[model samples]
Target: MSALQLQSAAGLLLLPALAWALGGFRRGVAPRVIATALALQLGLAAALLNIPPLRAAFALIGDGVNALATATKAGTALVFGYLGGAPLPFEEPFPGASFILFFQALPLVLVVGALSAVLYHWGVLPAIVRGMARLLRALLGLGGATGFGVAANVFVGMVEAPLMIRAWLARLTRSELFVVMTAGLATISGNTLVVYALVIAPVVPDAAGQLLTASLVSAPAAILAALLMIPPAPGEAATEGEEGIPTGLYDSSMDALVRGTQDGLGLLLGIMASLIVFVAIVALVNLALEPLTGLTLQKVMGWALWPVAWAMGVPAAEAATVGASLGVKMVVNEFVSYLDLARSGGAGLSDRSRLILTYALCGFTNLGSVGIMVGGMTAMCPERRHDIVRLGLPALVSGTIACCMTGAVVGVLTPP
Candidate 1:
């Protein structure tokens, strides 16, 4: 392998090394487990991106996401009329065509949420999550409940996943609690993935698969980070699951439809509110920054994450630009970061840089997410609220590191 190629694979260890250092070289059985997880995730990512059959199978994710959006729009047009219909002819079109990201794209989050609930109610999702959770438990030596929550994050999201194992949250040790939060932050939810796929289809092929792969890889990546930063002490393990994941939260499919749409409505409102507040704040920051640094908020964020991108073997010249997306993912949210990336597609970035950025920016580790995580965990097990607060920073750090670890794997991958 060339020097850069070697560096790419070697770079996978950087986040773990950083975590170890942060852990004060804590002694635990985690090294083997974490390394095993990283290796597995990297192998899967490489195969998915390069091996012809695997790549072809995973490519179905993009088509599925597109079909999903198209289907959802059809429903919207039936219910919402021209408000949700195709754009009308314009007398003078802008250089870049404009449409409402909220109405046109974000409504898919509701469809996804409702569909997920229906599938889970029908026992389809639980069967899959349960099987995957057992596999993770066997691989990572995680206690049943922790493994279950981690696996569930792939489907429901950070906020809802913990609800699956709520009965045992209070029994988990501080370090184990750290794992739950870290895993939650490390992965993006299915609903958010759909919204993101809708936004970035312009630039990336297999957007859904890449995002899904990131979440899959990052679960163990987050575990690795947590293990290093706060290795479970002797006798410290998550409590075994005492109950199956709750089901029948709704009476019928129609009820599930109502509940899911209600959940999505709340999320849609929250997303809009957050966007308005954050965008205004970023604009203000840029106004002040423009005079002193001749850079905007996004550029500053890029500068902050440049080291991570460089470490991942992104071309040095483009490192800062890609890093800015990481900065946005961490500071704001993945949704905004993705929007920024789509706006700057291939802006002098090589394929390697783009691939790394896609993996790196796929997660729910923004500052705003901390409150939601804490609140959700607290609601599940109120007594652990203090522990959640105490461990929040480390969890956040581990989550960010986890995403970067996945990015490193993508960077090292030999694409077909």
Candidate 2:
């Protein structure tokens, strides 16, 4: 095997081993379960990425996503004028110099989010989720409700996905609950994926396809990580719930549009606020420490996570860069990390490193998401609130590991 492939192979083992060591119930971790999960993830990755026909279909989907992203400009320009990418009354200082992230890039989330809600209202998304859920249940040996939750997460937000199986939340075993939480942290919703794709498209070819597959493959990875960290006991299974998304999620297509728009607006505002505050906080910290240590926060984080990036097949010279991005994703959020990656245009990294990081960072595995996941699931089943809280951190860790596992798989499959 090639050197890079060998490194990626090692990462595949190293990540799961880390999960096993951190397992809450080590004795319950079954070898057969781990092997099956890993095999499922690898098989899916091979089919989605390595198979020619499937790859072509996904590439077409990626092109459609890019086109959809472009369609948002019409609305943005109408709302925000020249600042949102409309023709400037005055000429720019240079070509492509007039870009404004707030007005131009972030608004895409709002459009995509609303469209996703409309799709759900039309039952299109639920149909897709339902089919995928059955497939996952058969492949991963998951209960009906657990499988639906995992599948729903791929198309909807973390909180919304659980609503589909809300009836069964109180009855889920500890392991099942952990798996559900991990799946949320491990995958990105459809609306946000568009924004990430927009930021990453400049650096990564077929950014949309990569993001879509990363979310799809990461669902199984989440299950794998959860099983390793907290395996279910014999005869302990998830309670079956209603098999599909609840009909009352939206009153109608119009209601879906309005509600989705409001939700998207809230998300856009939150992201804006987060970026503003987190960037300033990092700057302040950097200012306080730079003179004493001659290193910034990113560099320190890079140093801390250097081994992880290197293990994922990143080159020695570029591992720190990849590590810094991973650190940002964990410390703050994936949005900030993708912004950083886009700003740098994936410079100082190989194609392999960029691909790996793209997959690695395609998750909601930040500290902030722990609270979100815990609160969302707790709200669904008030009786299980304590269990949700206890499992939150482990879910975060397991979910992060799952994302890295997906990256390692991509690295192994990627030609050097």
Candidate 3:
């Protein structure tokens, strides 16, 4: 094995150690749970990435998902015309200037969201989620609600994942709640995967499939991190009921489509508003900091995080750049980090570094998302709001570590 690959293998071990050392209740950490989670995480990554058949299947599914983005362009063009990738009536001063994210890319959430809802209503998505939940429960010995929530996060947003078990949120143990939150932060939702895949498509091969695999593999890592940070007290592990996942409420296929579209619209608006606010905040902060410190926010963060990136098997020359992207993901959001990744492209990065960061940055672990998680959980179970707030930062830590773990695994498995 190459030195870089060896470093990645070391990273797979070091990240969990970091989580354990940072754990709030060290004595309460359950070794059995931790061991199981680690084994499951490593095994899953190997099977999915090493085995040719599984890799091909995932690649095919990823291609199908990517195709969804293409189909969305058709709908977008009908509504948004030239701004949405349709041919412009007249030539512009600059090529590609007509492209508009609001018109061309964001509309994809609507299509994927609508399709996901329809599938859930038809029992397709629910069945798959339920099966995964069952397997997770059996392997990790998690509570039913916890497993359901984590599995649901693979296909839905953090807020939506807990919606399936909202009634039980107040009943979930502290460890389970942390797991749910961490999983949400670790995995990207299906509806938004298209947007991310599109952003990194220029640099990352099989972007859609890699994103999908990253989400799937990150769940166990998140669970591992959560367990280390806050293992359940004896007898508190199964506090919630074992009723399993609840049924969908959509009245029919058409109702599912309509409701999903509405949800997508809300998400689209939220994304736009958040981006505007956060980007402006970053710009203002950078402007202030640059004159005083001779450094921007990204640069400062890069300095702090480059060691972590290097430990994750990034080459020394590229680690600072990759670390900067990670800092952007944590402080601002993944979308901006990915846009930066796209901008840097081959000029500033190697293929392996791009692949590693693709997994690392494929998450919702930014500060903004912490607020979203807290508020959404608070709304669902007002009485448990304090617990939700208390666990928020720890969840962010666990989730961020989880993403790094996934990247490390990819680094180890991929050829140098």
Candidate 4:
């Protein structure tokens, strides 16, 4: 293999490398599970991204995303009337000359959240979490709370994942706590799944599956990374599958619906506000840097992260272009990086680069999230506040490494 190709394969173990560097890496720590997960990710990526039968099965997820968006419009249209939808009473389009974030993406998140709550109350969601948790704990040798948190993160938000194990937070060791944080940041929540799908469905045919697949593959990546970074204290036996959404969280079915809507509103506001501020800050930075070296924020990001992208087996000519997405995902957020990738319009990008970028930018691993994790955990478990602060930077690093590992798997498996 070429040097870059070898580097791409090595990058698949990037998270382990970081964990080793940080100490606490046992020579015989779940080695079978680690190797299996890596192989599974690469094999899964090749199947979904290449094999006809598997691709068809996963592509249905994208179709479902499209259908859900349409369904969301109907819910919005009924409640919001004219303003919520496209057509107006007579004169102009309801949303006016252009699409609206409030009318579109936010409403989708709101509806998804409500549906999620309803599912939870019906005992459906917990059943799924328990099943995944059992499988992970068995295969990965994880403690109860950590296994559940890792599994729950795939379906819920990062902050909400720990809510699944509310009672265990204060008592969790630093190693266990870091796993919670890393897992949360390593995967995307189900609510944003549709929002992100909307951005790339046009360019990538199986957008939903690609996004979901990214999270699935990263779960093991995050687990192994956390284990290597901070070995759990000996004899640390966490609670069993009951580590899920707190009992009595919703009084009635209707109450669950209302609570979900409220939660979604908070998320909608945060996502919209973050995008506005981050985009503006990038513009400001580019303006300031333009005078000195003619380097915009994007160009600087490309140059800085080019090595990572190249190591992921991107074409030498287009490594910077792909690297820019990685840099943005780390510094800002995945939402911005995905938008940047969509803006790239996939011009001159090989299939491998596109697939790697898609997997890499599918998480919440930026610096801002460190504060979010710390603040959220503190509110839930005030006693462990000190531990959260201490593990913030390492959690961020671990999450970033996990996402890169998935991308590297895709790169290494694809033909050069």
Q: Which stretches of candidate 1 lie over 4 Å from their true place?
A: 78-83, 87-89, 92-96, 292-296
Q: Which of the predicted structures, 1 or 4, would earn the higher TM-score when compared with the native?
A: 1
Q: What is candidate 4's CA lDDT for residue 394?
A: 87
- As for candidate 1, its clashing pairs are 302-324
Best by TM-score: 3
Give the Å error, residue 85, model 3.
1.6
| Shift in Å, residue 250, candidate 2 | 2.3
The candidate 2 region of ten consecutive residues with least summed lDDT is 236-245
lDDT per residue for candidate 1 within 158-231, as digits (tens), equals 88888888878888877778888999999988899988977877887778888888888888888888888998
Cα displacement (angstroms), candidate 4, residue 192, comes to 0.4
The C-alpha local distance difference test score for the whole of candidate 2 amounts to 0.85
Alpha carbon lDDT of each predicted model: 0.81, 0.85, 0.86, 0.78
How displaced is residue 119 in candidate 4, in Å?
A: 0.7
lDDT of 2 at 169: 85
Quick one: ranking by TM-score, best first?
A: 3, 2, 1, 4
Q: Candidate 4 — which pairs collide? A: none
Better of 1 and 2 by lDDT: 2
lDDT of 2 by residue, 80-144 (tens): 99998798999789866899889998898888888988998898988898898888777777888
RMSD of each: 2.0, 1.8, 1.6, 3.2
lDDT of 3 by residue, 1-416 (tens): 89999999899889988887888547665677777777777687778777899779867866786688789888888888888878789988785578787888888888888888899899998888888888888888888889989999998999999888998898898888999999999999997888888877878877887888899989989988888878777766574544656675788899999999999999998888888889899999999999998999999889888888987899999999888889998888999888877766756878888889999998899999999989998998999889999999989999999999899988888767
Please provide the root mean square deviation of candidate 4 (C-alpha atoms, Å): 3.2
lDDT of 4 at 60: 81
